[model samples]
Target: MIYIQLFFSFLKIGLFSVGGGYAAIPLIQSEIVNGHGWLSMQEFTNLITISSMTPGPVAINSATFVGLRIAGLPGAVTATLGSIFPAVILVSLLSLIYRKYKGTTAIDTVLGCLRPAVVALITAAGLSLSQTALWGELPVSLSSVDWTNALLFLGAFFILRKWKWNPILVMCLCGAGGLISFLTGKFF
Candidate 1:
C-alpha cells in the first residue's frame, strides 16, 4: 500500500522533473503534503531541512524519509529505487541522443529555461524550511530568528564562497545543529 504509493509518486517525480533533484522538491512536497497526506506541513519542512543536510539528492532523501516513516526500511529502499530508476533509464537513453543534439538550439533553449526554474525550486525549499523553523507559536518574525542559526548560515555562506570547504563539513554542521535543536526541545 504505502510502498506502492511511494513508488508511483516518486516515479512520476523522477520521470517529469527535468532539471534534477532540486527541481523535484515541489513535486515531492505536493505529493507528501497534499496528495497522500503522509506528512504535515511542518513535518515536510523538517524533512527538507534534514534532506538538505544529508548525503544524497533531496528528492531521494525525501522519498526515503517518507517511506521510512510510513513502513520502515523496506519502504525506504522501494521509494529510493523508484525515484532513481527513471533518471537512470533516461540518462542512459540520452547518451544515444547526445551525439545528434549536443549543440542544437533545442537543447540550448531547454537548458536556459530550466535554470530559472531550478532556482525557484531551491528558493521555495528554503522558504518552506524557514517558515517551519521560525514562526512557531512565539510570534517571532525574521528579525527575531535564532542568532545561532543566523550565524551558522552566514558563516557557511561566506566560507562556501571564499574558500573550497568540503560540502560534507557543511552538512555535518547543519546536522549537528538540527540534532541539538531537536534534543533541547525534546528533553529540556
Candidate 2:
C-alpha cells in the first residue's frame, strides 16, 4: 500500500512538474511534505540539498531517496519509474508533434509562453529553497535565522559575482568553510 502510494505520488509529480526538476520542487514539497506527511519540511530541505549535490535531476534523486527511506530498493525503483514516466511519454509525444508541426506559429507561440512560466517555476523553487536553506522554515522569522549561513551566502554571492570564479570551486570552498565553522563552533 505504501509502495503504491509512493508510486502514484511521484507519478503525479512527474506528470505535472513541467519545466524540469528544479521546477518540480514545489510540487514535490506539496506532495511529500504537505499532502502525504511523509517528510517534514526540514527533511525535505535536506533532501533538496542532497539531491542538488548529487548527479542527475533533483526530482529523480528525491524520489529515489524518499522511496528508499520509505520502502527500500523496490520502492526506489517504482518511485523513480513514476517520476520519469511522464517525461518519457510526453517527450516522445512532443517529438512527434514537433516534427509534424515544424513550422507552425501556434506551436511557436505555445513554446514562447511556456518559457516565462518555466522561469517563474524555477524562481519560485529557488525562493522556497532559500527560505529553508537560510532559516530552516516557512514564514521566515528573524529570530530563527542562521546568521552564519546568511553570511556565507552573502560572501559566496559576492565572490561569485566579483571574481567570476568557477562555481564548483566556490561550492567546494563554501563546503569547507561550513565544515570549519561547524568544527570551530562558529555556526549556530
Candidate 3:
C-alpha cells in the first residue's frame, strides 16, 4: 500500500512537472510535504538540497529520497520508476510530435508562453526554500533566523553570481562551512 502510494504520488509529480526539476519543487512540496505529511518543511528543504547536490534530475532524486525515508529501498525503487515513467512516455510522444512539427509557429508560441510560468514556479520554490532556510521558526521572529545559513546563502550567491563558480564546488564549500561551524560550536 505504501509502495502504491509512493508510486502514484511521484507519478503525478512526474506527469505534471513541466519546465524541469526546479519548477517541480513546489509540486513536490505540495504532494510530499503538505498533502501527505511525509516530511516537515525543514526536512523538505534539506531534501531539496541533498537532491540538488546529488546527480540526475531533482524531481527524480527527491522522489527516491522521500520514498526511501518513508518506506526504505523498495519504496525508493518504486518511486523512482514512477518518476521516470511519465517522462519516458511523454518524451517519446513529444519527440514524434516535434519531428512532425519541426518548425511550427504553434510550438514556438507554446514554448514562449511556458517560459514565464516556469520562471514563476522556480521563483516560488526559491522563495519558500529561502524562507525555511533563513527563518528556521515560524512567525518570522528576528531571533529565529539562522544567521549561518543566511551568510552561507549570501556568500554562495555572491560567489556564484560574481565569479560564476561551479555550483557543485559552491555547494561543497557551503557544506564544509556548515560542518565546521557545527563541529566548532560557532553557529548552527
Candidate 4:
C-alpha cells in the first residue's frame, strides 16, 4: 500500500511538473509534506536543498529520497520509476510531433506561452524557499527573521547578477561561511 501510494504520488508529480525540477518543488512539497504528512516543511526544505545540490533532476532525486525515507530501497525504485515514466512517454511523443511541426506558428506560439508560466512556477518556488530561509517557518513573525541570512541572500544575489560568478563557487563559499558561522555559534 505504501509503495502504491508512493508510485502514484510521484506519478502525479511527474505528470504535472511541466517546466522542470525547480517547478516541481511546490508540487513535491504539497504532496509529501501537506498531503501525505510524511515530511514536515523543514524536512521538505532540506530535501530540496539536498536534491538541488546533488546531480540528476531535483524531482527524481526527491522521489528517491522521500521513498527511501518512507519505505526503503524498493520504495526508492518504485518512486523513481514512477517519476520518470511520464517524462519518458511524453517526451517521446512530443519529440515526434515537434520534429513534424518544427516551424509551425502553433508550435511556436504554444512554446512562447509556456515560457512565462514556467518562469512563474520557478519564481514561486524560489519565493517559497526564500521565505523559509529569510523568515523562519510558516506563520512567520518578524522577530524570527535571520538578518545574517538575509544579508547572505542579498550578497549572493548581487554577486550572481552583477558579476556572474559561477554559481557552484558561490554556493561553496556560502557553505563554508555557514560552517564557520555554525562553529562560532552565529546561528544560535
- Per-candidate local distance difference test: 0.78, 0.91, 0.94, 0.92
Query: Candidate 1 on 65-168: residue-level lDDT in tens?
Result: 88889889999898888889999999999888877798999988987898998888778866665655555324667665665566566667787889969977
Judged by lDDT against the true structure, how good is candidate 2? 0.91
Of candidates 4 and 2, the better by TM-score: 4
How far off is model 1, as Cα RMSD?
3.7
Give the lowest summed-lDDT range of ten residues in model 4: 179-188
RMSD of each: 3.7, 1.5, 1.3, 1.3
For candidate 2, lDDT tens digit of each residue in 22-48? 999999999999999989988998899
Q: What's the CA error at residue 171 for candidate 2, in Å? A: 1.8
Off by over 4 Å in 2: none
Q: List the residue pairs that clash in candidate 3.
A: none
Name the candidate, 1 or 4, with the larger TM-score value. Answer: 4
> How many clashing pairs per prediction, in order?
0, 0, 0, 0
Residue pair clashes in candidate 4: none
Better by lDDT, candidate 4 or 1: 4
Q: Candidate 4 residues 1-188, lDDT tens each?
A: 99999999999999999899999998998999889999988788889988998999999999999999999999999999989999999999999999999999999999999999999999999999999888868778878887767877888899999999998898888888777877887754
Error of 3 at 22 (Å): 0.7
